[model samples]
Target chain A: MKQLTFDVAVIGGGPAGLAAALAAKEQGATRVLIIERNLELGGILQQCIHHGFGLHRFKQELTGPEYAQRFIDMVCRTDIEVMLETMVLEITNQKQIYAINQTQGMMQIDAKAIILAMGCRERTRGALRIPGTRPAGVFTAGAAQRFVNIDGYIPGKRAVILGSGDIGLIMARRFTLEGAEVKAVVEILPYAAGLTRNVVQCLDDYGIPLILQSTITCIHGKERIEGVTIAQVDQDWNPIAGTERDISCDTLLLSVGLIPENELSSQVGIQLDPVTNGPAVDSNLMTSIPGIFACGNVLHVHDLVDFVSQEAETAGCAAAAWASEKQYSSTRIIASTGKPGPCCPTSDSIPFDGVANECCATWGSTQIIIKPGNNIRYVVPQRICPDKKTTLYLRVRKPDQDVSINVGELKRMKHTFIRPSEMIKINLTPELLARHQSDYLDIHVVKEMVHHD
Target chain B: MIKTVICTVCPLSCEVELTISATNEIEKIMHNRCPRGKSYATTEHIAPRRTLTTTVHIEGAIHSMLPVRTYEPIPKELLHQVMQETANINVTSPIKMGDIIVRDILGTGVNLIATRSM
Candidate 1:
């Protein structure tokens, strides 16, 4: 058994963790540690060898490995410590981490602040519950990608992808380029689950058919995947009778969705947003359990790695601040002048009550709640501290053109189009926060219809 | 002549319509949101290019295969040929990132460089 302490401890050494650790070190965190389960620092990016990454951050189209290398190089130059092949079994609410590794049998890490960057995992065939026999040829799109790109082995000669996700679309092209036939990409939704560019460059460019409003009803195979039975779904998502058709294929790749890795967060009693499937945090990316921050896919599944880096930087800087004893006192205002209403008395001084106190004691700043109204799926940083500007990332329930995103009269921004696949970002400055009239900030989308003769 | 191209410059994926003269020169572009979209439409209409990313066989490395991609996008028409050429190639381990695996692929003057170190 070994014991250690750090100014900041970051879980998961993927893009998010890598960015966070670097930012924390740069922010003057004396001792920062990154724990990675993988043998290498780069996570899924190692297997994601395709281009189209780093467009926003670097202004150049780069492969996932290249994008990751840039950060890995920067991390190499810093004094940040990384624990590779270390699995964090649990994290306590007090910022204590219990982990295990082959080199270090058992270890306990006590940190002043923690950053959760566990990233996410792909949804599998078992999760989808597709009626089928246990087969060897079945694989998730990511698994197939790893097999082909990293291991130099083709999963199958012919394939049928279950979801039109970005990975599935990219895999479809990869298979085709490797001399395999991609039969079809069947998506349950009418619209694609991936970026529009993926639909065009991966499927449309290759002449692959994208079947919408359809799903695989059954998978037929005993030893290996022989084929699949796909069917069109009605408005209610029930398979319509007589619309079922069997397509012969050697492989079935599931690209349904991704779930954030938050078992540790749940175990630590961190409140999670049901919609985002991640911990609900405040403006500083601090989770319900103060001093514990979260970012990247573990916060919410993002379409771009560039956004993940941006978010991780925020968490890293905040964690460093907490560790350096500079915590958020600067942003906290007097309770009397707090927007919405006067702050309630501190919970520690008063008797335990049913209502939770929403005010911070150090500066008496009231926490304002943010709620999604209509068409908007959910908003991150579910709560905001009005002292500084905060960025809210959200997703729409449906696609629309000529629409305005209204934040309860506090802020409004017009967009040419908004889609569920693309996450929207809105910045609420301190000036906008000053006009807050309610405890709850409502965000809704209002679409303007266009007419053509 | 008119060609409709979906700009892959960004996720916006604007559908840009390119009007070309009979002499194969781009005359006008419409419906693009940004300058990059206009350039993408023109280049894609005239001579589409795509960066080819794939794995190549590696010996004595952490992994059996190493990911590689062309330093620059080659001609779209040369993708299949270049892929075929790259398929039969193998490299030894101890390779560094940015190491060129294949030079002047398909006479496109684009070199296939290693994206990872092994």
Candidate 2:
């Protein structure tokens, strides 16, 4: 086995990893390495050939490959090391990394700081628990996307897509353009799980019917997919018996949801937030394990890749600071204690076990706990250091118009509308955070009512 | 007559309702949050356009295929013809990003450019 050492090691080499590695290098981290399992530096972005990316970061519409190429070009100009076609086997809390590649055989990397950017995986049909025999044509929307976009192979002639995610919506249009018949896109939620732009451009423009509050209850066929049984669900999501109908199609695409990839984080004992299913991070995006930080989808599922890069840059700069032995007072305060703290009181209480609390002992520089209150789904960076400004990304439980996102009487931002499908970002400045008297900052959403005259 | 069109310019996806005159000119636009949404709804109500993104066959490259997209949004009705024209194209390696694979695609003045370098 060969041994190597670096100041920072980034896993995945996707959008998040690319941004993190570049930021770390720019932040004076002399030795930075990015380990990617794919043959190229771009991860899932390679297969995502559609445009509408980089709108926020670049202020222009770009395809996934185009967005990733910009970062890849920047990385190539720097001295950051990249290992393509390398699979990371294990990662320890001590910042030790184990990985393997065809040429290097077994390799071990000792790093001063590690960044988790493994990204997220698409939820499969098996996880949905749809009753049916094993079939060959059933595929996740992402797999089909890779097949058609990258591999140039159409999955089938006819298709019925479940879960109106962005991928599923895009695939519906792609299949139509490829001359494949897309019957309908069935979504379990009342509203689409994808961005409104996708639902309009991909589905509405193509004249594809989007059936809401419906789900595929059964997958029919033995060897190959023959058809599926789609039924409308009530408020409880239980299928209405008489509403069951069979749609004849050779292919069934599942785009249910995405779960953050965190096996490596869990292996190293990084505490995860039950709501986000990612590591519990502080304001600097550092995980509970001191030098280890996480960002992007591995930190939480982000609606846009632009935000992922922004968050990763935070993690990268923090990791670089740690590797360079920078004595930031805020870091010292947060890193002093590793024990879990108390959960903030909320009306809709989340289980105490689900919250990973880290209390700090340092004075003058106060540590604040961010709790998701009523109607707020989850907020990233559950802990915060009030010494600096920080952005909190969150989602609401349902759709509402004229809502106010309040952060513990310190700050409030108004929005025309809020939805679970779209993440809401609120920036808390140092002055606003310093004004709060309580150690626990409760973030909640309140729907404003308008009276008709 | 009134027609509702969802603006795809951004994630806001404002559902704009267009009130048209008897001659099909847009009389009023409602529910649009921004000027882009208003213009997007106007164009969509009149003539829909979409940017085409797909892969073309490539040889002597690191990968068997190269992802490409139109330089600008073309008429939505012409997407099928554009895809058909792209399907017959085969390019060689050393292609650079933004390099034109097919110029003036389908006479719409929109060129299909390579989205990535191979």
Candidate 3:
């Protein structure tokens, strides 16, 4: 068995892993390596041929490949080693990585720190439990994207999209441009799950109808997709009687949602968050197991790639500091401030002056757990240290106007509107943290009452 | 006449209302949160444009198609016509990012550039 050693070992070389490895190197970590399971380095970005990425970080509207190329090129220019076409078989809490490739048969890599950036996978038809025949035309929106954009084969001449997420809306236009007719984009929710810009540019501009509060009830096909039975649903989401209609189409694409790939994380007994389906982490992005960190879609499904990169950089910097034994044993403080568009932004620099081992020992005893309350769905970085600034990323359970978000008794902020599809960022400053007397922060959202004359 | 437009500047999605006169002039705008929203609604109502992004046929590359986009937004109505013109482009690989595939496509004065190298 050939054994290799690195200061930081990154798993899955997607947008997350790429940014993680680069940040690790730039943070003065020696011997940083990226382990990619795919034959190429770009990952899913290769098939994402649409524009409107990189609006943040780079402040430019770049296509997915172009956004990925910026990091790939930077990684190439550095000493960051890359292992393509290699799959990680197992990972141990002791920081031992067991992986295999055609060239290197059963190799074991030892790392001082490990960063998980495996990303997420699209929800399939089977997950939706759509009662239908196992047909060839049924595919996820991402799979259809790969076939049309990368593989150069349009999935079908006429297609029906089952969700109104960002991917579904993009594919509606893609199918239309490829000389195909998109019958309709049926969404079970009353509002679109994607961004407003996408809804306007992808569907409205194409003259494609987005039917809300309706869902696909059944499939009418044996070998190929013949059509789908659609029905309007009630507030309880159950199909309304006599509201069923059928639309004939050759393809059906499910753009339901995404789930973080956490098989390896759970295999090592890392604590998982039931809401995010990812490892529960603290301010340093470190999982339950010390010296092991998680970021990107593997941490939580992100709406944009720029935020994934920003988050991976945080995990990378933390892993590097952990590998070099530069920070407090298990209580490294990461300071973040302000609101991110849809994700939390890790601060550029936080002076660690006087962060002694003795100082950090008492900080862990002062750690506070963040609890989701009221209309709050979940908040990331489930725990926070009171001595430093921590940016909390959270989502609401429903849509409302004049919403007031409160973080225990320490802080409160008001927003004009808050929706389930959008994540809210709130920064916990040191000033606000000092007022926290409770052992846990119960963060909740409440709609303010309106007054009339 | 009054028309309402959804501002796509950000996720807020403010509904901007525009008052138009008989000769098709915007007389007044209301309900926009930011200056960008007013501009977005004005352009959307009068002369709308969209950045054209699509794939073209390529030979001797890792893939059979190359992703390309107009360097700037082209006229909204000219999108389908311009897409038809780009279909005639037959280029070889060994191209780099920002490489131009078609110059002034369909006389829109917007060049079609490659999104990434094959």
Q: What is the TM-score of each candidate against the true structure?
A: 0.94, 0.95, 0.91
| DockQ preference between candidates 1 and 3, better one | 1
Better of 1 and 3 by TM-score: 1
The regions of model 1 sitting more than 4 angstroms off are A328-341, A344-364, A449-453, B21-25
**lDDT of each residue in A275-378, candidate 2, tens digit only:** 99998877778887778899999999998999999999999987898788553455565556543334332213343232333323321244677888999989
Least lDDT summed over 10 consecutive residues: which range in candidate 1 chain A? A347-356
Best by DockQ: 1
* Candidate 3 CAPRI level: medium
Ranking by lDDT: 2, 1, 3
Q: Would candidate 1 be rated incorrect, acceptable, medium or high by CAPRI criteria? A: high
lDDT of 1 by residue, A349-417 (tens): 122121124324332456667778899998888777787678899999998888999998887889888
True contacts kept of each: 0.85, 0.78, 0.57
Greater TM-score among 2 and 3 belongs to 2
Q: DockQ score of candidate 2?
A: 0.82
Cα displacement (Å) at residue A19, model 3: 1.6
Candidates ranked by DockQ: 1, 2, 3
Clashes of 1: 0
Candidate 3's C-alpha runs over 4 A off are A328-365, A449-453
